[model samples]
Target: MKKSKWSAYLAVIMASAISCFWAFWGSMENFHEGWHYPTLKENLTVMAIQYLSFMLIFILFSVIAILLPKIGSILYFLIGVAFSYWIFSTRSAITLSVVLSWLPLTLPLLLIALLFWFGEFKNRKLALFIAIGFPLLICCTISIKMGVRVSRRFHDGNYEERIVKGNNDVTLVWASQGPGWPKESIDWAEAQRRCIYLKENGKELADTPQNIWRLPNIKEVTSSLTRNGQNCQGVWNPEAREANYSFPPDKESPLWDIYSPIIYFWTSEEKDKDNAYIVVYHGGVFSKPKKMRGSVGFRAVKSVKNR
Candidate 1:
């Protein structure tokens, strides 16, 4: 068709190729680090399948934007930016959810999209400003709204089972309302290991949920369980109002009790196959799984506010 259109399509192809190459390099290295050795050819084949599948969506989307000019390139840009940013930031597997994280990446690209779609720099300054400003406004506003929602929910007794803390190491409160650790029997061994890890890493576990601790060889996690009804079919703990009650929907929640209050999460401590413990809230639970591949979900603990 148009020479300009051809140029844009080439650019899209080049960008996609570059990104694919980068992902390939990174994934290969990460696999080596994780496996403690290089990947076999079979593993490489599978990883190739996974990687190509993951990169294809963005590449195809970019192709479409190149092929069509009238259909709202802003949307296309959103797809590109959000997808690339999430891959760069979180480096999640090439799954649909990670693909969706590409929404944020749309901002800067919007300017390019406008340039390509309109072929005019007449209002470029204003358009570029809007492009940059839009995503920031959306992200910041969404974050603030979520914070407010969480605060309101907590005040409404939703998180009663969780402990909250300030960034300044406020004397920790066990999930005050629920049956949390006895405080006297706070498995000191696991706590020592975790402190050692943190000290060595020199990294602080901020307000993110991962900061929540599951003490090794500890049983405090059992105390965090609470059922909303007499049936004990795994309802939110009434005392859990203080906890960041991210419990899945009832239909999605599995039926079990004295459950670790969480399931199937990566623990800071792994003891071979059958036994290990994971964090629940800033190092709170410390439940010892009776079996490997247990499904005790997880949540993080972080400062109430980063400030």
Candidate 2:
């Protein structure tokens, strides 16, 4: 093969690899979150659309470049410029780190555009194959991996309230659906208020604020982390700001809805008046602004009755 053909192949590989990475990431995210939808058909449909949307643009560009090089070159350049503008507009300061962070995405795009414009490849078939085949292979590999992981996950199909006993003589009845385990992200204050207003059964809210349920403390969350229906023996150290576990916990049943996108749960521990601590599924704790609510939720718990 000539040098120009090799360069064209490299450009095709780069574009396909970049698109495949985004496709894989989007697929995993959709798999994690899309299962919560009502029906199986809905879940599959939504997941396919969500992940495929990420790759469609790149696939179109590749096809157009193979058919009409000049048009594809213009499209790729426009996309690169759009990405650069978005990145710079979103950041308050145009630091080297910012530029460097975006270079991986924008630079390849610009370079690939130039390559498509000037490079000559007699074997258009090979160029098309590299463009489409590589992404297909990546998507298939990721699908198989995600399928295995999902199949192995522990799910009892039970979402009822349960009493969990943990280290430090901590025992609490975790709330079921509703305020205890909400699907939507919530601010710290709203989480607290919802927990306070949660009724005894944990399925509904009361007219007046009730004390039946409240946000679990960081230690309580850590200590109660479980895997395969067994305690993980998690311990939280406030001084060190760390959590240790005999067996690392996961986003599993009883405590967490594995299909839900909410991975971090708000705890009662406040870093300061402005920030509050949240616990992750794997027994990691971090502080966030009290008002930040993207992927963080709350699970209400009440002290177990003396027995």
Candidate 3:
């Protein structure tokens, strides 16, 4: 009711909200990467633990802060200092932008610590409820919304092959699950080499280098982008190095494994000797270093043999 009490409640709310946002973000990322599809091979329990670690840690901090303000103040202060040090040390050059970015993450912790130390709250029970319940409610609401969306995703379980007819009559058969369609992230060169070595069946690799299958060019990949089993009508502009699509493609069946973390596919189009073009699930095109890996993969394609 008093001004000081209102400030204390606000501090608790702010801290809880920030922690909850990050926890929810992390959880959503994990869900998309690990739990969206039933065929995902990752252990559900392990993924839950790994993704929800942030939420658990923050919840613990919230409990301690609500019950013991003095100790909580010290804990938050130390965390703020450590975070500040980390921000400064990791950057090679300190600029206004860097300082501005640092403030949002570090300043709140420091302020909350000060507020908790000085402010008085007679209703600790209500404070505890606000601190814990608010975040839990937020996380649950958004997660349910996302879960519904993910459940509605379409997967015909036909990863073996798909006939994608592109502009200029560029028709090709996308490879099935094997060397032609790798599940893990791979560098551009390795992807190219793998494609070159892929067998005609598109599911096996040969000992000697072969050209049965190869990486799809940027134009072919862009035009083949699809959404809900429908082509997205994607067009690539090499001069501008950009792509336009009638509808945004999603991580779904046929072209992509919804559960896989690989979002970008390496294209045979090269920007230069050092960099090559890659296409995203949404049909966006960008150039990345040939040697770079992580979240990047390749799906070998070949000319339709019978056609």
What is the TM-score of each predicted model, taking all chains together?
0.27, 0.85, 0.84
lDDT of 2 by residue, 100-176 (tens): 98888789889988887776778889888877887777777877787676655666777788787887788989888
lDDT of 1: 0.36
**Clash count of each predicted structure:** 37, 0, 0
> After aligning candidate 2 to the native by TM-score, how far in Å is the CA of 283 from where it should be?
3.9
Cα distance off (Å), candidate 2, residue 32 = 4.1
The CA lDDT of each predicted structure is 0.36, 0.81, 0.79
**Which stretches in model 3 have alpha-carbon errors above 4 Å?**
1-3, 36-47, 93-97, 166-168, 272-274, 305-307
Residue-level lDDT of model 1, residues 1-307, one tens digit each, is 3335443443343435434544454354323221111234644465446433444444444445545544436655665567566566766456766556654454435554554565422333443333333333433454355334322221122333334322223322232212222212223243433333331112343223333433322222222322331111222232342223223111011111121223222333545454455533222334364343323433222223321
Pick the lDDT winner: 2
Candidate 3 Cα RMSD (Å): 3.3
**Candidate 2 local Cα displacement, residue 186, angstroms:** 2.1
Residue-level error in angstroms, candidate 2, position 195: 2.0
Q: Show pairs that collide, candidate 3.
A: none
Task: TM-score for candidate 1, please give it.
Answer: 0.27
